[model samples]
Target: MLDIAEELNAWAAEGRDFAVATVVAVSGSAPRRPGAALAVDAVGTAVGSVSGGCVESAVYELCRQALADGRPVLERFDDDEDDDDEDGLGTGLTCGGAIDVLVLPVHAAGPVRPVLAAALAATASGGAVALARIVTGPPALLGGALLVHGDGTRHGGFGGHPELDDTVAAEAAAFLDAGRTGTVEVGGRGARCGSPVTVLIESAVPAPRMIVFGAVDFAAALVRVGKFLGFHVTVCDARPVFTTRARFPEADEVVVDWPHRYLERTATDARTVLCVLTHDPKFDVPLLRLALRLPVAYVGAMGSRRTHLDRLERLREAGVTERRLAGLRSPIGLDLGARTPEETALSIAAEIVAARRGGTGVPLTGAHTPIHHDGPLGVGSPA
Candidate 1:
């Protein structure tokens, strides 16, 4: 949802109205990721999104209804959602993906705001957070939400029974540190044995991380661009003299250390990005060698086609393979005809985004693969 819970809490705090649209599940090709969201405020204001366009207008209308009646909605958009043209947004999934959405009308709900605010803080600060929504019945089921921290303690609940709280707390603790979402079945506790508790657990880290090795001019520029693109940018160079706070002020931390050793200790998750900007072969060769060994999401080394080719041969002699070598975005960046440092930075950033999103940077009409891949739910997969 990308800070969406916070947005709803904010809207409620101001006495303004907002509706949360959630993608509960999907059965076919879905354009947006599962945690996709769209929030509409009292005055038709909106934040976040649910789909490409097929059902957003319907969602907005429902948001208005939610504001009017103070009600929560569970809406499912199925394969038959081919209706057209509402509120000038038009309709249809040109990408050919079916999606499901759940819209909940929001009120301050007292602790709902503070609990979710704590959640937002945990997410923004790189800590993990989880929430259990008693979708069916509860001591406070209908509008109740629980916030669990990464460490698995009772911080806040939907003002429910202590038994229900303890049961959900223990069951949900494992999910707190796991930055993925899932459905946990907590039906054996005191509240009711057969009734289920649906926990929506989301653990957000401090943006995707990118450590640029060797704080040269390109390193400085890459740090700025990386931060703009929501990376926890770090600038590292072994030579303390070249690595300075003044050269890379945009960087979150300027470290003077051998790049390979630092990443080996800190990098985790496929979301981490590593950029080796030192053109010097002594540093670049080893940096590239180390990056190839990690499971990071993206790794790019700054150098020319010739320089990259030569480095690859050296890597091959040192026993690195073609599969790993293919992962490197050499002569890094897009085909943006970038000539200067700033332009090159933009191109590199664009390429990274494209790779992250699985986009080919080509026109949709000319592409053969479906615009939308099978989302987490595998909406189109045959059962």
Candidate 2:
């Protein structure tokens, strides 16, 4: 749902009522992840996707039903084609998997509008926000939602009971801090153990940042690739003429400062990526020294094997430990025999994807690896 937050925001601003169907859980080889959403507005307009195509009509009808009743519903779709006989709606997915979707109606005049507005604003402003909704609970509590900001401020209400609301709020805050999106089950004095309440915590975090150091032609091409991969890309160079926005039109930011100094004062998280396109020692050595020490997801530099060795020695002299040096991906990008700037950018983007998803940068045809490995039911998915 957060993926289409802007569209929802427009509807909310116009005081329009709409319903959303969000994929909350997946099993086996589902097409989409947990946060994938499909929304339908009052006039029957739809946006976003949940199954890529399969089962959309059923989900859309469910959204309309939810909008009409002012209630929420949880619908499950399986890959077994035989199941269609039971539902008569042909809601079975052909992806040979199963998914659970929650159809929730958002009222423009309801208490949740402010929270939705906040979430939409956060997406644009590069802040983090979490939205928690009750998917399985008593009739009065179902579909209840609460919004929590990074600074601990909260809006909206849930569960009707203060104890229940407090418990869910605390849990939502914890997940928000971790930047995780998933479901949590609660049952206790405020909620019965026999009948548990499941809450879906959806976190809308800022796009993972991709800092491209050196505004060369390769960097300009890579900036477009980074943005296409849903990153907030920034191109930086000490040279004012080369670091202009006109050169890298798609970059979210163009910084005209020394690469090392810019990185020293910028903020980064585990999902952030640092790409050093400047192979020169004057720019590469200092910036890499800081990049390697940080906790970002990827740190790669473009250079030949000999250049990499020289850069490594310089970084070592600058006090970067051997263990930290192991994190660097020098001569950055996969070996694809790339010659053009666009081709080189593709290689780098491919390598970045491989690193983030734990792929081996090898052909999958002969490999025995699972086609999907990030889902909850994937072979090595986290417990």
Candidate 3:
């Protein structure tokens, strides 16, 4: 699946035949969302996971069986252990949820192999692509796939009626535009007639942006953490000497322009997170003033308690509204008694993830909150 595209792409390039089991639907408290996959190669080597660990062994065997028979299969695993008699695999998820997985073999001569390979290559290269496959349909149409690109181009087909392909492509394009991965139902023979078919649209978009504004040591550690979180990180500081590739090697880009100036021209979306580490009034005021007003996921600034108060006054004097300032995460990062740069970066990254996933900055051991919050499921998720 697109989640493990890089590793799967490498396997495909090496001419290794494999079978992949991808989660197409999920319900209740499933640990993994849709588009999560587990793949096993001809040599029984495995990569990636569908459930965190609950049903991996069963999914692994399912992949091996798929490779052996060259037939696509759709199986459901749930928390009902008593239902083992229904399926011979007898695997039950203990996560108090259910998932539907589609297993398909990717042999060199398989009709769907090339399309899968193309999708893996595009996704690994950071190109926007969507793979739409039939999760439930007629016998011949099951597991058939179509690859849709960002530019509205498409390759492969479901081998269904022409209208069915057109309808699925259009729906897949719409999902790709929103960077959404889920299911869309359509009639079998085009939009007009026949049995209903469910197509799973898995989208692979470029990672969201994490712009760290400052070139201090904390920024270096934050860059590494941001990259670890699958963000295309950018480090921007007006001081060219401090902003260098050597200092923040993990950052995708190092900008020498003023923080506000660079952000003014950069492409950002609701998913982008802005971290302002420059505590100087000049840089902090201008940057925070702009960042707080932007439609970004997070806007955090690093400063001391005294410095935070002073910066707040300066921003208020700069005409920033109280509502806008309310969004600012001054004195950035959760409280963990952080002393070192790495520890501070961890705190900051934890806060950012907490904000994005709607988590409280509190210990979970004694808390009654759900481990996974009901937050927005980003691209490639079936929420």
Tell me how far the alpha carbon of residue 326 in candidate 2 is from the true structure, in angstroms, after superposition. 0.2
Query: What TM-score does model 3 achieve against the real structure?
Result: 0.92
Q: What tens digits encode model 1's per-residue C-alpha lDDT throughout 242-291?
A: 99998888889999888777766775556777777787788877777878
Candidate 3 Cα deviation (angstroms), residue 54:
2.2
Whole-model Cα lDDT of every candidate shown, in order: 0.68, 0.83, 0.89
Backbone collisions counted per model: 5, 0, 0
Highest lDDT: give the candidate number: 3
Structure candidate 1, residue pairs in collision: 27-379, 27-380, 28-379, 28-380, 29-97
Rank the models by TM-score, top first.
Answer: 3, 2, 1
106-216 per-residue lDDT for model 2 (tens digits): 878766667767776775566778888888877777777888888888887764578777777888898877767889998733454656888888887777889999999
For candidate 3, which ten residues in a row score worst on lDDT? Answer: 374-383
Off by over 4 Å in 3: 81-90, 192-194, 377-383
- What TM-score should be assigned to candidate 1? 0.74
Candidate 1 Cα misplacement greater than 4 A, ranges: 5-18, 27-31, 41-45, 52-57, 78-95, 110-114, 124-126, 134-143, 154-178, 182-200, 238-249, 261-269, 316-343, 354-363, 373-383
Q: RMSD in angstroms, all models?
A: 5.5, 3.6, 2.9
Which sections of candidate 2 miss by over 4 Å? 82-89, 110-114, 188-194, 375-383
